[model samples]
Target: MSAAIWLGRFLFALVWGALLANLVWPFPGKGFALFLILLFVLLAIHLLQLLMFASAYRHFVQWRRGDYWQIVVFGIVGWFAILNAQPQREQELKR
Candidate 1:
């Protein structure tokens, strides 16, 4: 993948991490139970973001017939590739 795509993925992870941390880290020492709950919620949000990215890549691969590994290894860039995978006008007219 291109460096720009890799950078985009980094930005995606960074933004999500920052947002989740901002929401969860401000209440330190409230209680052990609350801390554990917040930790679980943060982990869940991270997982959800990953799953959403993977689903988008998978959907695009089906239509574009591109390499699956590109999506699996580079993650969000795969989805971006799909987003920018517009067929040429000549190609579109054939279908």
Candidate 2:
């Protein structure tokens, strides 16, 4: 994996960790509320990305549960990893 992807994954992990921590020990004030709203918005966007990816690749790629989860968590970075991991033939077919 490239440094950029690793960095993106790390930042995503931190965001997810913070959200999990907030769930266990709720933060005080309106700022936290705004954060929750932002988080939900992000989740919605990721879900949409997942759907688009699945629809676009369903025929050529073998879908897996882990792939879905990764895309959901990592968003575009996950898409990048998946595309780059594909064999050259598959990649060409996608064009």
Candidate 3:
């Protein structure tokens, strides 16, 4: 996946991790109830985000099928690959 996509996944994982940790961290008492509520809320938000992701993927796939996104995706991927590959290239050149 793209860097942005990977980073987004990392951040989302952090969110989920925090939510789960909240239940146990900072003591376990009345906050547990609040945490339960928060967990449910997070679940709802997570579901919505998943739906949105699915919807976006569906549209993107459709666009790809039409060849409308090929250039854009290629350019973005090329840009990221080149930018990130520079350090490796320098190392290889040194070797």
Candidate 4:
């Protein structure tokens, strides 16, 4: 994987880890509220990305459960990774 993708995955893991930590120990006041807002916003953006690309994905790719999870966590970067990983023949078929 590229460094950018690895960085994105690292950041996503940090955010998820923070949320999980908050659930266990909890953050105080505005911090907790902010974390919740961040979580929801991220989820909404990821969901929109998935929906926007759903048709193209269904047509051109054979996706697994992990692919969906990657999209959820890494968003558009994940989508592009999947696209770039496709065989050259499959990519040409889109043209």
Best by the lDDT measure: 2
Give the Å shift of residue 81 in candidate 2: 1.0
RMSD of each: 8.3, 4.1, 11.5, 4.0
CA error at residue 30 for candidate 4, angstroms:
1.3
Model 4: lowest-lDDT 10 consecutive positions: 84-93
User: Which window of 10 residues has the lowest lDDT sum in candidate 3?
Assistant: 63-72
lDDT of 2 at 27: 84
lDDT of 1 by residue, 1-95 (tens): 45687687687567556545655765446654565675566556545655675576554433444434445433556556655554553367578
Q: Candidate 2 or 4, higher lDDT?
A: 2
Number of the candidate with higher lDDT, 1 or 4: 4
Ordered from best to worst TM-score, the candidate numbers read 2, 4, 3, 1
lDDT of every predicted structure (CA atoms):
0.56, 0.82, 0.51, 0.77
State each candidate's clash count: 0, 0, 0, 0
Measured with C-alpha atoms, the lDDT of residue 46 in candidate 1 is: 48
Q: Per-residue lDDT tens digits of candidate 4, residues 1-95? A: 67777787788789878977766777998888888788788889998888777766687686656778778878988886776666754666688
Q: For residue 24, what is the lDDT in candidate 3?
A: 66
Off by over 4 Å in 4: 88-95
Q: How well does each candidate superpose onto the true structure, as a TM-score?
A: 0.34, 0.80, 0.40, 0.76
Q: Per-residue lDDT of 1-95 in model 3, one digit per residue for the tens?
A: 46674565456567557667876674367876776786787666545544544466553332223122222223233234334555766677689
TM-score of structure candidate 2: 0.80
